[model samples]
Target: MEKNNRTIVNAWCMYDWANSVHALVIISSIFPVYFSATALGASGTPDTNFFGLQIKSSVLFSYTVSVSFLITASLVPLCTAIADFTGKKKRFMQFFCYTGAISCMLLYFFTKDTLIPSVFLFGLSLIGWSGSIVFYDSYLPEIATEDKFDAYSARGFSLGYLGSVLLLLFNLSMILAPQFYGITEKSVPARISFLTVGLWWILFAQIPFHYLPAGKKKEKRDGNWLFNGFLELKKVYGRLKEQPYLAKFLSAFFIYTMGLRTVMYVATIFGATELKLPSQSLIITVLLIQLVGIAGSYIFAWLSGQIGNIYALMIGVAIWIGICAGAYHTTEAREFDIIACTVGMVMGGIQSLSRSTYAKLIPENVTDTASYFSFYDVTEKLAIVLGTFIYGAVEQMTGSMRNSILALLVIFIIGLLLLYRIPSRKVYHLKLDHREN
Candidate 1:
């Protein structure tokens, strides 16, 4: 019943802590690195069969991500509509959460031989993780005040970074010291890590699952879900059409974050296949990124207060541009680590600020939080679809992921230009105030 109770807020943030291991272990660190190595045999040919045709494994992995997001983008709006119409947000969130955890556990069986099944399971895990977050993010405006959005968002990310780092350290210990665990095959440790990540996700999620409030009790009898969802989406679009800043910000967010998401998704692949960095070094590098991102989240949240979210995001986007350019020229292990660490510095900050900024932008009176946040997430999934697809396509065509860097750099530049067109904090507030009064 309380609006900003510490207990409720902490419970909400714990969801971030729950699901973040998926980001660290599955998507970012161990899994991508493992996939690349597994696909590239001892002879080191990157080509693998995907349906009778040979496709580069890294590019296939990229397509996997893009496809998962495409499905997520399709499903999110309809799911959110159901959640909002029936006030069953908690139920929908739990469904996705458990689905993702089980999907992740199934990934323990993924090997070079079982590539297709594994890839689909991996896609399912992605869909589940991403879907739950849409419902989770919609809770922000309902639970926290505008002034606290940045702080709460940053804190949530900090907790996620900390929890993910702790789990990753455990997984790394197993991977790096397999003999100590009596593990014979190198792949065993990584496979075990996948199963553990799923269990961890399910375990930590209970804390928030028990504490966060379930929404409206009203039940909808209409079975026309597609039609009903379209109606909800139409309302959301109408609202955005009225708010120029929100619409413009969404555009910029989509463009720049497309590049950002692609880099995060494929950075491990690049390091593994392109830079020829060992898996150990790649995972360690990710750990470093996670550790630094813990601080980055709070740092950018504070910076947002000082200079406004828009300007702070612009600065972060500029840094991302530099990262892409630097990565293009990087050939050594040490140089790649530098680029990765720099990515950490802005990764959390940019993401946290973006979510909070969107929360702050949404008018206070609107109560269909699930539908609104789904629209925001739809933008993200679409961006990721385009970004990862382009990355894969470029790599497949050019025989190198380096060409993808040029594409990402261009995306950041366009996003920054669009961001520049938005009104400053003072002007944005005046506009919001004018609307309110």
Candidate 2:
């Protein structure tokens, strides 16, 4: 278990490459627009009946995303606790990887007539994509030394941006020029793009599954695993309370990430709906973001090395506040692209730094890394739930996404205040054992 082992670090990082295709193509870019267009019909804001209440298609889409994150947040801790107890984190990761990949492929069958099934599969795929990351991120403390955490984490995100951008470029070509591929309908190419994401994810995931080491198996215990898992989670919660710095960091992370995740998830839709940008412009703008994000991840990592993680994170938060304000005022396509580029610069930095910062703060003696990261992941997922719900509610009531974007400013300000209170001394001088295996 040598620190900064090349094989282990590369294998671990490759998982980001595999999964980020889904993050870009399905979650962030193409599929949301496709879903809205398909589900809402020609009117662009059709009413739908859910259980007993009627709601707008756009609002329903946001609520569906919230529900998916809510389910993942509730379930992942127990699942990770079981993985930690059994020493089977790799197996759990593999299960989600396969589940999510298959779900992405199933999206090829989605149609306007199959709204319920389409939404179900979309949520399932999101669960698979996001749920696997808890264990994948937990591997960071095991694979790299403390000093290398920020760079290693940033490298993973950089690779993800590069890899996903390549696939998206190909998919964009197919969607934009269907005649070259002998496809008659526009939706046909889009469906094929979904299949490409599925295959790419599963095929690349083999690298991590083959090379990332599985730690020693735990001793078999005499108890119901479900009950044992809950007990284990309860113990971790108590331990988290004892680490006040980590607790405060997680609170700030939860608040800011609420705004961050919502913006990332919905930005493309916002452009299409509120700004009335063409599909071609939206796709091109996303490509620009991905290209810029590769540099953004590296820049923020270097900045963290020079100025410290807290300051770099605060800089990112400040940029996000500006992006939200800009989105509210920008109506022209050129202005929107500028805002998108600004988003590109800060998105990867904030996300990558947050992960590395948390990795640095965790207790080294702790054996159950998956359980610890499960709590971290839960904070993020719960934030997504709250952020998306609030955004959707505001849009639904006011009938304008402008107000929804502005509301995120409040969340960002609160997060910035919380982040300022975190003592810098606690994070910078950690002396951790590098012999984790």
Candidate 3:
């Protein structure tokens, strides 16, 4: 395998570094709490029940997320396919990355009273973040040798964790240092922190923009581009049926990713609502997870070298089951740290390894990377829909985060079993012909 593209490879990985901050800061960290408590702040008192739901706010959160998933599912693959056909994966990436970053910058306007523009910005940011990932992921196989794929894939995740930690640290400093730093919650520094995330994402992302080689573009349909994009997607749907291992991998990916996503979306909310932890403490714990996550990503990358990618993935899923089960028995903040540490270890590896594995398995079809990876993108989105709502419903019914966490083990277990049923040797053996294109 040729191995001289370090600059290009690292640049590609840094896109994860750039974009994941938005995921950590905007989507995962500040925005959820902001939306729940501040953005949707009612004037005097709020209704406890709406449409037969007691947790009206949580229900709204769940509904908004569901709709986001549907839109992303329908659109993302086509977006990916267009990138593939036009050989514009890089261009598509720049377009969406900026869309997401600009949206994060706009979040500063969302104070107590203004909500719609804020929500709209957040939603568009979600779309941009997700849309960009479709092509960002498709670039994996193009830039790496077979022997290097797992480590390099894991590298992206590791860098992403580091990026998240940097932004989180800066944000934490702003919130904690109002007196010493001349920053206050009601003033510009707090708002500047939000703007900083957008700047971080956009500026650092230009590294990849400069280094990576352009993907090959095929001539699209002779007809209209919109109609052509639809036809290309249908072609992709047919192609998926032709590839058995790819289909199997995707199915397993969907189930396990659902469990992973459920843990991500609900863990903090559970900590704050059920364990009675303060917001400041909950935020600190999450930042700690990001720091620990940097170590975890490299650990799994090394482990995969010794044990192989499939077995490493199995180890990750096994850890998820334990993390969920452990949450059931936890009664204190100390216990929360244990579960959070377990998550930090497995989350990066599972995502990175799964992606590299798929990159290995995809057939040497010319100009179908986006269209194919779109299945990957949409399945990832649907996982959020299934997991969040299921977790929310279980919590609503039992009125216990403990039961909800325990139930998530079923998804991890089933996905693990399905993953084991796939032929591991085939993954390592997959090859592409340079002659195909």
Candidate 4:
């Protein structure tokens, strides 16, 4: 790979800006509240039956996210592996990105009459959004040198935060002041917000699609693409065992990500259910997080430069432990707001540093970058399944989300310990095939 080019790097980062609208509006903030209000009615609790089982709205949403992760975890590796074999990662990324954006647009049609369709589209969009991320991340190594990964990764996340916040602010205006848009009902504005996310995603994605370089080399087509892809992935898995440093990093990543992802996905619901916050407060809190996150990503990136990525990540994890504790004790809206601000500061830092740290750990001269990132993404999605499951199960068993939040402390601690086991200097070596080089 050549040295980093400014245009390509900017283009790559813009995808983060593009897709993050979906993350904020559809995944983390708006959709959850809107869907709960719509489906469960004014009680804000789940009274609806799914497959003959009565479930709470929060539990139902968590399980829906788990199912989406399950499907993505099962399928993304194979898809990424096939893309690597064919050297068409860009095409694969485009497919997932467009699919996800269109799915967001489809959410406009969802209502009480079409609950099943809503759930299906929500899951589909999640899959599309997350699946595209695998290939998007793979481009990092290709676009920038290892030494620059931290800054580039942080820039991408910061841009994402800023872009999403801008859109969410507009969406909030529409929801909070519907008369300004000539809308009479809240539901109409909420549905229109979903449509805006899809349009924004599709429009901004074109910049990256146009500017990102194509795969440098192409593998010859064998009659058996699926079989070849699996064989290739099996070989990569075998090779991964020889890289102890990378392997340990991945272990820590998987564990910590469980806590990280669960918090990102469920914190809004927790605020609504446990803190008894209204929609306005929850949306505002989410906006604050995004605003704070822009600084968090940059600050953490700088912190990584000062103390190293590993130590910076450890600090971020420590803050998460504190946040979990605070969440357990929070009863007032003010207490929750303080915790939300803390979460915002650490969330972007941990996520940005983790990506750069992993990028630095990857073996030099590796060819199947997409497949490598597929393994990374699959680890993350599976962790999400485990984390969301534990969260939902704890709530069901204990009859309180407080316990569920506290349970994350164990995961964070375990991840910290695992991270400690990794050597400060990169020690693992991987030999590349000449064909791959």
Candidate 5:
């Protein structure tokens, strides 16, 4: 295999910039809340009361996402394996990205008091969005030099944050100028803004498809693609047993990633439910996080360069702890400012470092990068299960998301402790001898 150079690395990083618009708009900022309050099947005026719980639109959106994550968890690894066997990571990425964009565009068709279509579209979009990311993530080693893994990974995340910001600015413009843009109503502007993401995602996603190289196609190793995919998973499991430190790092990452995912997924929801903030406020808050995230990525990248990956990751974990604690204790809108501050500071660092760290652990010559990343995907999917299940259980039993927020402390603390036990320097020296195709 040829060594990856700087140009390839930058191209790979740009893929993040392309797809992140979908994440920022459909997943994080505008659509979820819209889906809850207006998109789906609800009676006249769109009932806010469901199952004796009266919560904000975003919290309902979070609940729906938790449900979708539960389903996606069960299926992504198998899908990943198939993509690997077919040697079509880039193609598969394109397929899913198109589906997600189409799903996002479908949001515009959702009418008042008819949310079923929107809900379905949201779920489909989530699946397509997340599934494509597994393949996108697997391509990191193909584009990054071993020594520059951290820098490249951080670059991807930084570009992604910037991309999200640009889209958000456009969205904010559409929203503010709805009347000028032919939107004559209150929520129509936001709905139209949601449609823009699908367009942006599809347009920008072409860059990688047009420019970045895909790994070579591979013949099926032992059986049919799906069957062989299943077999590949078992082999991965066996490999994990021999790599206990990597396994341990994975275990720690799984938990903390879950906590991070849950906090981000539910932050806007929690604020709307607990703080009773309006939609406009939520938009402003998310914009603030996006801006802060840009600064945060560079800060952590520089910090990691000075102190090492472990130190940078620990800083992120510490901020997470602070975020959970702040959420648990705050009673006013100002508290959201605290939560946003911590999240903006740490989210990119944690994700970028985790991906690069795992890239280091994996051998350079692994043929089925998509299949191999299936293990990584499983951990990520399972993290959602653990975090959401625990959060939902606590919230239902205690009747407060505050208690749920506090519960994440366990995930962070324990994951951090386990992370401390891994010897990064030793793992970094491991040979990359697995080259079978």
Candidate 6:
């Protein structure tokens, strides 16, 4: 209800600085390339046998990601409900952080012969990362006021982009010129990078853990947490049915995230296999994406202040449609680089704005915002499941990824139509009830 404390805000943003290294190094840049290039068998082909079917390595990677998302999507709601009911969100957050960082550290030993364990640990780390975010996002409203939601949301993402890039740049040098660091084996540098990311994730996470509010317990923890959580989700769903705008916004968010996150998840892989970009070149282009993303977060925040949240998101969706089409058409390495840059420019904007917009739109003065955001998280992860699964299945069937890229276009168009139906305003407010609440 008052102005946000500077130290507390910085601490909250710092966790983004900490955990984002995992996102960049493990999920986006280094691991994907490392798995494709160095984690292969004696035969030098990026193919793997799964259940007697031979599949390309990248396809298996996407499928693995889908499985991870499915696991996370299924588990997060009850965890958040337990956190909501018990007021121990900080504990839940810390537990997952440790799990992920430890899982990441174990990746240093991964090789061709260790494929099964590698995939299992990778999925575990994803669950850890996704699980921690359930509570991390709940802290957003606790730290900032309604007016500051968009700006503060943008600030968190900006910090994440900047921090991850700093780590990525340092790690890139080792991967490129391992001899400079006295690394003889080609895979050693990448493995060492994975080790660094794990240490970075764990050590820096303590900042927010020390300062964030332990959420207030609403009810006694005497019942079955899993079953009570389901009740909580059912209650939130009932509330949403009465609020058309929030319901509409979430529906759009769910559909569009299927396209947006799938692209983000698979972009680096596509650049390598489809665009035929080298590992060095792919990481460099990804680096550019992070650099531009810092500005993109602020740019969209300002645009939200100027044009309103819903309209700004529509424009972002339009840009995404172009990006998907462009990716489908562009073949040259340079053209793909341009697509990567465009993605960077709009990616931060859409993600930050979408988050803050939903925060602002939540039922005013509700303490159980975690349940609302849990619904949001579930919507996103499930969308990802469908998107990545479809992407992989289409590639499996048609024997080409070209149609896979085009499929995102249809998804975005649906989201754009949903967004366009909302009434235009200069800005949204917490007073959806017009002071009646």
CA lDDT of every candidate: 0.92, 0.88, 0.76, 0.87, 0.75, 0.87
Model 5 spans > 4 angstroms off: 39-60, 426-437
| Model 5 per-residue lDDT tens digits across residues 1-437 | 45566666666778789788877777676765555457333453323554456543444565667777766666666777777766667887888788888888888877664455676788788777877888889887776666777777778888998998888887888776786677777777777776887888888887778767755766647666667667777888788887786688788899898799888777766766667677667877888887788778778767767766766787789878877877788887777776787788788888888887788777665767676687888788778777876776787677777888888887888778877877655334333323331
The TM-score values for the models, in the order shown, are 0.96, 0.95, 0.89, 0.95, 0.90, 0.95
Q: What are the root-mean-square deviations of the candidates from the true structure over C-alphas? A: 2.4, 3.7, 4.5, 4.6, 4.7, 2.8
Off by over 4 Å in 1: 41-43, 218-223, 426-437
Q: On residues 352-380, what C-alpha lDDT tens digit does candidate 4 reach at each position?
A: 98888888878887878888888888889
Best by TM-score: 1
Task: Write candidate 6's Cα lDDT for 315-392 as tens digits.
Answer: 999999999999999989989999999999999899999999888888777888788888888888899889999888
How do the residues 168-261 of candidate 1 rate in per-residue lDDT, one tens digit apiece?
9999999989999999997999999999989999999999899888886556657698888868878898988889999999999999989998
Candidate 1 structure, TM-score to reference: 0.96
Candidate 2 residue-wise lDDT, 100-153, digit = tens: 899999999888777788888888998999898988998999888888999999
| lDDT winner | 1
Candidate 1 local accuracy as lDDT? 0.92
Error of 3 at 426 (Å): 8.3
Clashing residue pairs in candidate 4, if any? Answer: none
Poorest 10 consecutive residues by lDDT, candidate 2: 428-437
Q: Which model, 5 or 6, shows the larger lDDT?
A: 6
Model 6: residue 330 alpha-carbon error in angstroms: 1.3
Poorest 10 consecutive residues of model 5 by lDDT? 428-437
lDDT of 6: 0.87
Candidate 3 — what's its lDDT? 0.76
